[model samples]
Target: MGSDDQGNNDVGRSGFTRRGFIQIMGTGAVSASLAGAAIAARSKPVPPEKVMDAENTVKISLHVNGAQHAVLVESRWTLLYVLREAFGMTGTKEGCSRGECGACTVLIDGIPRYACMTLAVEAEGRRITTLEGLMSGEQLGPVQNAFLEEDAYQCGYCTPGQIMAVEGLLRKNPTPSLDEIRIGVSGNLCRCGAYTHIFRAAQKAADLKKR
Candidate 1:
């Protein structure tokens, strides 16, 4: 073959020599293999001892309402599940179960929180107040009474959460304005569209708390 033809054979139309192309392809293959190896190493299942397993159970003491109880719970167990199942405090309703709906509202350290979003282990040493906690031996608390008197709830599924939110709000602000009341229980969603009654109940609750 002519020298020019031989030279043309060494370099392709793309300006890359055959050997250079081979070397680049080989380097890319090696790099891809190394990257795959790194990914595989990273994707290996974490050791059970190194990571918290969801099935692992831990014993924890929870202060609920005015009582204390010890229970074993999985790391993945939500406060809503523990309250409903362990203590049978089903008053804390599980609405959305994703923290979107306020049906599972509870007071943790006297602050309103979504029980479904709270892990059971996190409330170990915290004071948890459910819907039933807002009662005195069959006598409804002021917030509950106001809710009842104002007819705040329709289906009553979200009532517990609403009451708890109001209780927390009143504890922080005894006299919240209408807008403040709206923002206070904004997390709780009443599917019955009883927002008007709920707002009135919050105002009534504030008054009832003073008495």
Candidate 2:
């Protein structure tokens, strides 16, 4: 064993020799290095919670079915996710999530927009309507009834957007003919070849408006 200028004994439990002192010093140096590293690690500043929260929050306000909603949404979330996840309005379908399909369409102030492509922030202060909003308590809206009676949909993947688009069309031109109905619904494609039925539903809706 040996004592350094620091008055610390440099020795192990074994017999204290010159080699034992060297070994003690070497172990102390290694221990001090590890302690410094641990203190440095503890002192490093932690990242802000908001940075993590960025993936979990954004401010959004929407006018839906004549009601207003203010919500905090995830930054990467789309309008469809907000309407479905936050608002529990799931009428909008999620098909071909890349926005190639119109199944996730909804009306923003009477104009149809792809909900999948729209951001929750983009829908701020806008009147948004989903399929759930199209009907009154017990009475189906004219567009919905027309789709039902005319059997406009097959698998019904695109029905919500189709019905909303029909509502928009009827609002613009109350007496759209069969050809006009075809043109009105061209933006919505039906893989089931139900175009004829869908157009008929639109015409039926126009007729209902006349009554």
Candidate 3:
């Protein structure tokens, strides 16, 4: 009992040395802390709350053309995104997203509007008519036929918007004069410089629609 070797090798109280005891105490303290934290978490759970973020999508119903569509769209999604991505209506091209270019034009409640400038939520309740809408089950509408006859579209980049604008204008004034047709499609820009043929096509479309 008085020997140094015996004292060092002695099975102390709790069968642990001073160094081992200290280590066990440190481990126990950490385990207790973790258990307490877990208990506190179990005692008071977090409640569900609405989170506003880009990942959040809202359900919307859009009456496009003659069909009704129910879809989920992001908060900041533009009308073009909904038309092309959401509804697969890619005829509404995305040009200048700032509304400077009329390439993304479509009809909203029979009014010509730039889809790029419009929001998806804004068009939720409105009638959205894209280029695809102008077809009546494989039969091209008067506006589309007129464009084909007059060869109004060169590269056809701006043809969809041009056709939509003319359609909207025709809806308002079925018999638009040459100047009126020019003014109606003024918002739409034809980068291919096909204004002369486009004007002729618009006039032809009006006459065809009237019949």
RMSD of each predicted structure: 28.3, 30.0, 30.9
Top candidate, metric lDDT: 1
**lDDT: worst 10-residue window of model 2:** 12-21
Candidate 1 ranges beyond 4 A from true positions: 1-53
Itemize residue pairs with steric clashes in candidate 1.
none
- Candidate 1 lowest-lDDT run of ten: 18-27
Q: Candidates sorted by TM-score, descending order?
A: 1, 3, 2
lDDT of 1 by residue, 42-146 (tens): 533232232346798777766677456678899889999998887777678889988898989899878899999998887765667777767654356888778
Cα displacement (Å) at residue 170, model 2? 1.4
My TM-score estimates for the predictions, one after another, are 0.74, 0.71, 0.74
**Candidate 2 pairs with clashing backbones:** 1-16
lDDT of 2 by residue, 28-74 (tens): 23344343344336544242233325676765556666556677887
User: In model 3, what lDDT does residue 190 have?
Assistant: 82
Question: What stretches of model 3 exceed 4 Å from their correct place?
Answer: 1-54
Best by TM-score: 1
- Residue range 73-129, candidate 3, lDDT tens digits: 886888899888876667789888888779898997678999988878777546677
